[model samples]
Target: MLQRKFDEVVKKEFPNAKDAKDTSIHYLGKMQIEHQLDISKVLMATSVCSDDINVPSTTFFNVLFGPFVMGGLGGVPFVGQTGMTAFAHHIPDNGSAFIFYGPHIGITLEGDLGKMYRPRMEETGNSCGALMLALSRLQDNDYTPVINDDDYQQMKLEESLLPYRDEILGSDNQAKAITEATYKIIDKKIHEYIKTCKNEFHVDKVTLLGGVIINTDYGLDDYFDARNFEVIDLKGL
Candidate 1:
């Protein structure tokens, strides 16, 4: 009953979202059937946020090979092209690659958009702590992110969000809006890196599952709103 209430709140923002575990099963089945991929041989890489909460969000973590983590804060593929090259090189012999990438938002039972209870916590805190921080910083009209080595990832995250500042700030739901914008940015970067490092992959097919991860309260199931699923023919690229 409590879980249902939270689902209502999450679905209000992401109507198409499904349980995270179910999503993993669905995609795994699709990869096996439609894409003809071998479940055991496929290597998995993740480009989601660095948040530990997201680690257990889906079964992909348990079922696949090295999650050659490619994302940093806000789910940006911060590891860049070199990382992509490494991930590609690490694919199982004659096996395909699967990349699961996205940004996550926490939805509370009371209908809040960006806060939830983490494991062992009694209070709701920012799920995408990096993203919420970015949103808070973005609220300041004159604040500009300066690129520096000390906080390069956060700076780059805010820098990537600059163009979407107006769109996100002006939205009816800023949390959801920023999350959506971040998804677009992450998706675009993933493709760019893949295209840039396409040759590094010896595999013939690369399956992609990109989306927004909706985090629920601790011990409850999370959800994934899939936005893109494709099996790229690397041979043609």
Candidate 2:
């Protein structure tokens, strides 16, 4: 039902996105143009890893929450209601900095909300889809695994593999390793972009949107308050 609703929404709003592979970018580009949002105030990340795409969402939930829940952790709390979790929980209980670590990652620095960023090497392929591909190789004894929306979602929600939860959710797991590595690269980029926003662009507050924010790892409390960033759900706008 959720998938159907998302499809319908995409179909209606993105009629011109016929050849566009990443629907999130298409919709977000449209939204940015429609609302005249300031690109300097927004930073976006996604698994699409395409520099051509603009600040982006439904694909957000699939990538962010699908792994944890399908790994048998169960659905995230309040996710269905607000479509975003706060960034507080992702931090260590005593930690200060918020580190985002999700698979199939992509980072984009948008300077103008009305325009799209050109493809850059640093902004693409910072993801764990390779790991997923490897896992698929082991499972199917095939050399290549085609990573797509349906396969990724099914892999996350597969119940027969529950016994392998340790492998999927372990502290030293491949998923964690991929997320950490990707985060390290993207974190520096984000800080650099944030610095530019503050120093050059004179932008103070950051606005985070997209389905990736819905994961339980994110929280809305003191963490963001300390950083002075705001969460803006596109659904509300």
Instruction: Please list the Cα RMSD from the true structure of every candidate, rounded to 1 decimal place.
Output: 0.8, 17.6
lDDT of each: 0.93, 0.29
Clash totals for all candidate models: 0, 8
Give the TM-score (vs. native) of candidate 1.
0.98
Error of 2 at 199 (Å): 2.8
Per-residue lDDT of model 1, residues 92-177, tens digit only:
99899999999999998877888988889877899789999999999999899999999999999999999999999999999999
lDDT measured at residue 110 in model 2 versus the true structure, 0 to 100: 21
Would you estimate the TM-scores of all the predictions? 0.98, 0.26
Evaluated with lDDT, which candidate comes out highest?
A: 1
TM-score of 2: 0.26
Instruction: Judging by TM-score against the true structure, name the best candidate.
Output: 1
